[model samples]
Target chain A: MAVLLLADVNDGALATDAVAKALSAVKGLGEVHILVAGTSAAAAAEAAKLDGAAKVLHADDAAYDHGMAEATAALIVSLAGGYSHIAAAATAFSKNVLPRAAALLDVMVISDVTAVVDADTFERPIYAGNAIQTVKSSDAKKVLTVRTASFNAAATSGSAAVEKVSATADASLSKWVEDKVAASDRPELTSAGIVVSGGRGVGSQSDFALIEKLADKLGAAVGASRAAVDSGYAPNDWQVGQTGKVVAPTLYVAVGISGAIQHLAGMKDSKVIVAINKDEEAPIFQVADYGLVADLFNAVPEMIEKL
Target chain B: MKVLVPVKRVIDYNVKVRVKADGSGVDLANVKMSMNPFDEIAVEEAIRLKEKGIATEVVVVSIGVKQAQETLRTALAMGADRAILIEATADVHTDIEPLAVAKLLAGVVKEEAPGLVLCGKQAIDNDMNATGQMLSALLGWSQATFASELAIEGDTAKVTREVDGGLQTIAVKMPAIVTVDLRLNEPRYASLPNIMKAKAKPLAAKTPADYGVDVAPRLSVVKTVEPAGRKAGVKVGSIDELIAKLKDEAGVI
Candidate 1:
């Protein structure tokens, strides 16, 4: 029951949270090996060795620079013969690529898994976290993408052998172009302990700044509902909903956000939820542990001043 | 170029799905059903392509129960030229599998030979998100998933997809599959006249048997249960009171 984890890297560094969580996922199954596919795998390789993993496999190739699903899926499919379970952090990258590998292997992918009950049994959220489903895979090989927020990070120290694997061909299905990611010094919305989110009721981008100020005061991350992101009040990455990142922070505050079912799907698991809105029936108040009905413009400033 | 859009009938996005007490599955009995939100975006994109003259014809295909015909008609009302409904039964192993859906779609793709295949990123029901990718691999065609923008040129389709990091643009060869992200396009409302006209559009019915693909449950659901819920807490009178509660009672601060 060997496991292969597709490592998520950023700016030449390996994303450790997902890998560590994934390491904990396949804990009792067997030895875990991580795949680092990128242009410069040096930093990621060095970091993977300390992931408490059995081995680190690096495929240094320019074709994988953008993580175009076609090439990355092919690379994993070719290497799929050795591993009993193939897993990745359920990020945009893994969500885009793991299914491709599963298709090539003629198996169905188990997505956003929260717990590994056994070698073949897994627990995952369905119907937007309102329901929990446990599945048993009859397929010989299990292709899975795990929700990183649900698991603890594996310890950071260990010595594992590093192996250089050959790169696969470019699928040429698509080419990478320019990017416009949000650049902020604030904590990342998904992993932040405290998340402060805004919605369309924020009025405009200028109003969204108040949400950010309160987040800064609380040392929290800024999140936005789908409407806020679509209304251009926040960056696309700031969206927290069914289509966006699923976060289970310690504290979640909704400012001017009338919770849509999709938006609630992403953050309902938070330890504590507080809603501040003028609309008492905004649906967000239904799940909020503490509800404050007031205009955000008035409420946010007061909260910021208090913090 | 002819376009192929595959749509799915899923639990309406607005509906609050309830897990059955018996643990069979999510209670779908008498629940409102609608087009998967992402698939609606795909349908809208294909219609836009047709309206722009980049595509000459748009064919909408769905694989599900007989009720799925309504989903196809909605696509046709939006502007698809025709529809195909692959008949499915209620049984999991004997009737529908995600792979079976892809295989049947491959048959349609072979027969229609559309230059572009558009579909949703995933269905809300199982959330497997693999059908389009599986179809692309089965056809040996290149693919672009989570596409937010699309532009068609000679023998190439340049697509911009939404990723966690940011938007990424890629060019896949013609005759490829593209899965739509939520932001791809806002679907238009079907006018009363268009809804009537969609009823007259050509709709063909087939089955997984026609595609010669095996239909069996690749994975089994062992148990289904309601997720743990947080109890409703007291409402705070003031901002200061909320802060005190957070620090003292909740201890999250």
Candidate 2:
């Protein structure tokens, strides 16, 4: 019952936190093996080893450069025959690739899993993290995508033997011509422990500066509602909703957000929710642990000053 | 140049979903369903391309139950020339996988041979973000995922993609697939005239077998449960108290 972790290379190696959580979820069942695919196989190997992987399988090829989701999925399925469970971070690549592989293998794929009760059962969120569901796979093979922030990233450090594996490239499949990664110095929202989000109440892009300051003070990642992002007050990457990244932070501070259902789907998993809005009847307050009814213009600056 | 657009009907973005008490899946009873917001962007992009003379015709397709046609009608109302609904019985989010949909879409592409294929970056329900890429792979065509800007010139299409770091511009030859990002374009609402026109538009119903694809549940739902409830925390009377709690207790500051 080996748990195989598919390490996607682009987001700076396997999502370490997700890998660690997946490993810890099934630590006692069997050995953990990580399959690293990308142009930088060595970096993947090193990262996988740090996550308590017993062995690292490296597949380095030019075709793996842009991380084409289809090719990667095909390769994983090809290699997944022997493993009982296949896991990967619920990133863009895994979200796109793994389900197809599971279908090809004629097995069940469990996605966005936050916990694993045993080798065969898993726990995950539904309805945008507003609800949790436990699932048990009846099939022989189980494919899963782990939400990186749900559990603490494994910190077991040990050098693992790296073995080179040849992954057949599918020329018939479309290749990624290029990738334009959004450059950011801040922590990735999905993995951040604390997140500060702005909503339609921000009024303008310049007002986001206040949210940014509050985030900086709290050392938190910045997020936005679909309304804010669509209104062009923030970049799409900052958007948090059904359409954006799903986050499970220890604390999520929503500023001036009206808390649409779509927006709740993204950050509702936070352990503690703090909502600051002028609208006393905003739906966000329904889910908030701490609700503040005040003008953001005065509240944000005051909050920053207090911090 | 004919353009192909794929749309999906999902739980309306505005409706709150409840997990079934039986732990089977989400409770969809009386839940409002709508065309995926991202797919709307794709349909909007394809329509805009046709309006701008880059595309000669626009065809919309969806994979779901018969009710999905309502979503197709919405797309048609927005200006798609025709619509095709590939009916399937599996749950759209938890059961049917993206690869299967891609295979089905690939068959449609072969029959239609559209010069360009446009889809949303990902459907909000599953948020898989795979169909477009998988379709491109199955068709052996170039792909531009998360495209914010797109332009067609001659036999090639220039696309500006939004990634994690910044914008990247890439040029792929015609007969390529492009996934529309949220920033791609603001989708237009269907006007009264277009709504009336949509009623007269051509819409065809088909099955997964029609595309020669097996629609099966690659994923199984173990159970559906509620997330952990958050306990209410102390509400500070002043900003200073809030900061003190955050710094001393939460240690977030």
Candidate 3:
């Protein structure tokens, strides 16, 4: 009947701009409903303020605090009867949750959709964004994971009514342990306005400071290529690639990074791309808006000094 | 305590993929195919579990074209105790959606009754990171997606997941499905002798009908095309020039 969207919550509020972008994705399909399934009511309240949503469904529960896929997916499936389309931002959160709900509903999920062609047709990147596939689903209900970068964020200018949802999703099969999330003063990689990334050229773990110094100079988030992460030059969370987090920031600076196709899939959509590397033949130069053929060790420090 | 791992045959990660000139799909003909990089990690993790005495056997399965047998053989060489190739499709282009694959795997899980199932978080070809989560749902079991670190203790598994912000650890009951991420562990290379030994290992060929699962296409491909390429811009000489371009020309700063 309506489109149900799972809200991405942070602490007690809507997480970043992802939900607003997801709202933009599900807006014209049907009656837009935002489902705030979390441990806090503040997130539901924030969802109610989103302009496009017709209503906010709040399912406040402790089991959802950790955002466990099992409980969250069960909650979505319990409310599946009232919606024709179920969607969420294609982050690690919803990626872990939505497909479970889709399988429970006996429907196929169109993961990381970049375009909504009508209600059933969607465009998604396949083969690490080297090829774009437009697919048409024949399922009764369409389950989608919206690639938020593909759409603009919906404005927050509405006072949609909030309804309470009483549902018990047993999460007895799983238990939340602990999170070792890096608590940084720097901007979050996915939501930052600018991102500075490093690669194997950044060299050892200690040498990643050059990339961080530049990121700090620009007040940007720090990111890394799969090469850097695999080499232990950076943490796994800092990876930016097809298998990693995707970002479409306004400014993306690649420091000593070779632009592998998988790496390009993550940040090729950036408005301004700056590549600082010694190797002129690196594929990153092809996509760079500003290419500097210089050693990043010297160039980054100099840039930091200039800034 | 057998650990089941599902591997997919995909275009090698090292190979640059090319979209078909006709724009129907990616050209798979004459392309180098290998076990998905992530699934190789899964197979390696399963074998590690057996080596650690946490699992008694490592069983690997691949659901795809007949060519996928090569992918399974690679897994067997990597140390899987046995292999199963479910020939789901004849055409290379007929990409069976995750829902169908999960259903078929769920059937295998019922028959094998492994203590755990480890799979790649997503396939390299489709980039659909849904199978493990879907399979967990179909089995009505717990799931830990994007797992980077996993440890089995008694009847539970403590998995450290690679989430957006950071690593989140969770403990799931046994007979769970764990979808692995990039940082899980380095996949080992199949040694020459092991590769030879793998050829003698028990390899079984099965069909979707054997599992009583319908392998039907739910999504129709409208078309596939190469993404718009970004052109190389003018190279700036100095830091000042780069800063000037960002502030004056681009205004992104």
TM-score of chain A of each: 0.94, 0.91, 0.97
Name every residue pair that clashes in candidate 1: none
Full-model lDDT, candidate 1: 0.85
TM for every model, in the order presented, reads 0.96, 0.87, 0.98
Q: Give the C-alpha miss distance for residue B205 in model 3, angstroms.
A: 1.3
User: What's model 3's lDDT at A122?
Assistant: 95
Candidate 1 per-residue lDDT, tens place, B1-253, comes to 8999999888888788888777877888787889988889999999899889899999999887888899999999988999999877663212255676887889999999999999899887777677888888778788889888899888998898888767777888888999998888889999999999999999999887887766667778888998887676767888999999999999998
Please give the CA lDDT of all the candidate structures. 0.85, 0.77, 0.92
Error of model 2, residue B202, in angstroms: 1.8
Candidate that scores best on TM-score = 3
> lDDT tens digits, residues A94-147, model 3?
999999999999999999999998999999999999999999999999999999
* Residue range A81-193, candidate 2, lDDT tens digits: 67888887776666656766675665656777778888788887655666677767776888888876666667857778887788887744353446557666777787788
lDDT of 2 at B4: 95
How high is the TM-score of chain A in model 1?
0.94
